[model samples]
Target: MNKKIGLWDLVFMNVSALFGIRWIAKSTASSFGLGLGAIPAWFIFAFIFFVPASLICAELASTYPRDGGLYEWVKEAYGEKSGFMVSWLNWTSKLFWYSSFLTFLMVNVAYVLGKPELAGNKIFVLVCSLVIFWVLSAISTKGMSFAKIFTNIGALGSTVPTILLIAMAFIAVIAFGYKPASTYTVSTLMPKLNMDSLVAISAVMFGLSGAETTANFVTEMDKPEVTFPKAIMISAALVAGLYVLGSIAITMIVPTDQITASEGVLVALDQVAVALGIGHWFIRIVAFGIALSVFGAIILYIASPIKMLFGSVKKGVFSDSFTKVNDHNIPVKAVYLQAIIVSAILLITTLLPSVDAIYNVLVTMTALTALFPYVLLFKSYIKLRKTRPNEKRPYEMSKNNGKAIAIANMVLIVCIIGIVCSAAPVMPSLGENIWYEVQMIGGGLIVIFAGLLIWKRFTKRTGFKESS
Candidate 1:
C-alpha cells in the first residue's frame, strides 16, 4: 500500500474536508441572524477559534503522528478507556454528519429538478439519499485513489461555483450601483448572545468547526511535523476568506429576514442573475455545482470515518471485522456499516414533521459527539505536556505549559457553551420549548454514555488491552 500522501494531496484533502458543501450550507444559513454582517464575524470566528485549535492539534500531531489522529493523542495522554470513548464519539459524529450531508444533497437536487414541493417529502429524500450513499460507499470501498478523485472533483465543483457567484454578484453591484441588502455596521457584525441569536451563531460556528480531521493525514505525509501545520494554516485561511466573501455576496442580494434555511443561497443567486439580465442559466449551473459539492462531501463523509474505524479496530478498540480491508486496502464492511447507520437516520427524518427540527437535532447531536473528543483532547494536551516532557514537539502552544492549558481550557469552555446554547430553545412557535429541547439534548447524551459503557464492558470481557 502507498502510505505516503503528498503535500498537494494533503492540501486537497484538508480543503475538501474543511470547506466542502457544508460551508455553503452554513453561509446560506447565516442569513437568518447576521445577514451580510455575519460574513466578517464568520471570518473573525474562524481565525479566533479555528486557527489556535489547529495549532494545538498540529503540536499533538507532530508529537504522535498516527492514523487514528485525535484517538491516538487521547490514548497517549490518557489511557485505553478514555481513548475508546473519544474514538467512538468521533466516529459516530462523522456518521451523523454524513446523514446531514446526504439530506442537504437530496434537498438541493429536488429543488433544482423544479420539484420544490417534494423538498420536504422525507420519504422521497431518504430513498434518493440512500441510493447516493450506497453508490459513494461502493466507490470508497474501491480504495483511496477513487476517493481522492471524487474529493478533488467535488472540491473544485463546489468552490468554483461559489467563486463564480461571488464574482457575478460583484459585477452586478458595480454595474448597477446596487447597495448591500443591509448596511454594514459594527453592532450588526457582532453575534447576538440571546437564545435566538446564540442558536444562529452556533450554526455559524459549525461551519468553522472540524479542523482535527486534517490531523489524521499526518501519518501519510513525508515530514508531517513541518508540512501538516503549514497545510492547516493555509487551508483555514483560504476557507475563512471564501466563507466571508460568499456570505456577503449572497446576503447583498437577499433580505436576511426572508431567508429560509432551505432556499436562501439559491434564491440569492436567482435574484442576482435576474438583476444582471443574465437569465437563470447561471443559477442552474450554481445549483448543479452545489449538488455535486454535497455529493462529493457525502463521499468523503463515508470514506473518512471508515478509515478511522479501521485504524481504531487495528488498535483494539473495535472488533476484528472492522479491520478487514479488501484487496484495494479499503474497509468494505466498515464503509457499508456506516452507510447503513446513516440511511437509518435519514429514514427516521421522514417521520419527523419538521425538517428544520431534524436538522437542528442532527446538528446538536453532532456538536455533542464532537464535544467528547475535545474534552479528552484538552485533557490529553495537559497530560502530554507533563508526562511526555522529553518528547520532541515541532510546535508548542507556549513555553509555559500552564498558560497553554488555560487557553485550551478556555476554548473547551467556549465549545461547551456553544453546544449547550445550541440545544437551548430558540423560537416559541417552532417547537422551541426549553424542556422539549432538553429532552432531545439529554437523550443524545444518554446514547453517548451508553455507548461508552458498552465499549468499556466489551473491552473488559474480551480482555482488550493496549498491547493487543
Candidate 2:
C-alpha cells in the first residue's frame, strides 16, 4: 500500500480531522450551563474520555492498521453485522456533524460580515450553510491531491484562534487586570456529580474524543507503531490544552451567560479585538480562518469514509445507483445523499429559538449519533485483546493487562454516560423543546434502522447472503 503519511502528516491529519476552534466557546458555555466549573470540567473530561480513548485507539490501530478503521476492526472482532452497524454510524454521524459544523461556520461568517442578526435569520443561515456544504461537496467529488495543504491550514485554523484567545486572556489580565465572572473557588471548580452539572458530557466528549476518526488513514503512516502513538500523544495533548485554555480564554473575556454556543469564540475575539484596538477587522480575519479550518475538515471527511463505504457496497447487495460514481470515482450519489440529509437537518435545527440553542442542540445530537460507534470501538478493543491474546500487536497498551482492562471498562462507562447526556435534556428548558429532542433521538434511530433496512432490501434484491 502507498505510504505517503509521516509523523507531522499524522499530527496534521489527527488535529484537523478531530475538530476546529468552535468548541472553545461551546465547551465553556456548556460547562457553565451545568453549574460546574469550566476548568475542572475540561480536566475531568480529558481524564475520563480523551486520554483513555486516544490510548485505546493507538493500541487498536497498531493492532489492526487496515484502511477500514472501525468497520474492519469491529467486523473482525465481532461479525459482519456489527461491522456494518459501525460503518453506518460512522457515515450517518457525519450527516448531523456536518450540520453543526456548517452552522458554526455560518455563525462566524455573520460576524465577519458585521451582521450578527444574520445568524438569527434562519433563511440566511440555511442558504449560506447549504451553499458552502454543496461547494465542498463538489470539491470532494474530485481528487484532493493537494490534501496536505488542507490539513496544514486546518491545523493552523483550529489552533491559531485558540492561541489568540489565550494571548488575549493574558493581555487583559496584565493590562486591565481582568477578573473572571465565575470565580474558581474549590467548591465551584469541583464537579457536582449530578446530571445537570455534567449534561454537556457529550459536548466535552464531542470536543475531546475524536482522534480515532483518523485511524482509518493509519495505513498510510510509515511506522504505525511509533508514529501513531507519538502523533496521538502530541495532538491529543495540544487539542486538550486548546479546549481548556480556550475555554478559560472565553470566560476570562466574555461572561458565560452571554456566550452563545456558535458565536462565543467569535464574540470573545471581537471583544478582545476592540479592547486591543484592532476592531472588526480581526473578527473578519479569524472568521475566515475558522471557516477555512472547518472547510479543511469538510474536505477531509467528505473525501474519506463515504467514498470508502460506497466502495464496499459495490461488492455487496447494493444497486449500482447507490454506488454510482462520476469521472472522479467519487460516489457522486452518496455525496448528494449526504448533502440532502444534512440540509434537512440544517433546516429543522435552524428553527430553534436562538442561534446558541441551535448550535448546542446540534452539537448534542451529533455527539449522540457519532458516539454510538465508539462504544463498539472500545468493546471491540477489549474483546479482541481477550479473544486474540497472541495476535501480533505492533503496539500494545502499557504492560499491565489488569490495568488495561480497568481503563477500558472505565472508558466504556464514560462513553455510555456521555451519549446519554447528549441525548437527554442537559438543562431544564431543554425539555420544553421535547419535540426537538424527540426528533433528535428519532432521527438517530431512523439513520441506524435505515442502514439495516437498506441491507435487508439489498439482500433480497441481490441475493447477498447475510453470512457474507
Any idea what lDDT model 2 has?
0.74
How much lDDT does each candidate structure score? 0.68, 0.74
Provide the lowest-lDDT 10-residue window in model 1.
Answer: 23-32
lDDT of 1 by residue, 1-468 (tens): 786877677767766666743444343454234455567767776766676677678788767777677778887876667776777777777866777667767667876786656667777777887898888788878766654556666778767867876887788898887676755677776665555556655566666667677765565678765776677677777887788778778767776666656556677778888887887666666777788767766665667666765567435545668777789877777788877888877776555555555655565556556666776787788778777667777666665777877777777776666666666665455654654465447756765887778677777877876653
Among all windows of 10 consecutive residues in model 2, the one with the lowest summed lDDT is 29-38
Query: Against the true structure, candidate 1 has what lDDT?
Result: 0.68
Tens digits of per-residue lDDT, candidate 2, 201-278, equal 677787776767666555566767677778877776766677777777888788776777778888888887777778
TM-score, candidate 1, is: 0.86
Off by over 4 Å in 2: 1-13, 30-36, 146-148, 192-197, 213-231, 426-431, 462-468
TM-score of each: 0.86, 0.90
> After superposition, which runs of candidate 1 have C-alpha atoms over 4 Å from their true positions?
1-14, 21-37, 138-144, 216-234, 313-323, 326-333, 430-440, 463-468
TM-score of 2: 0.90
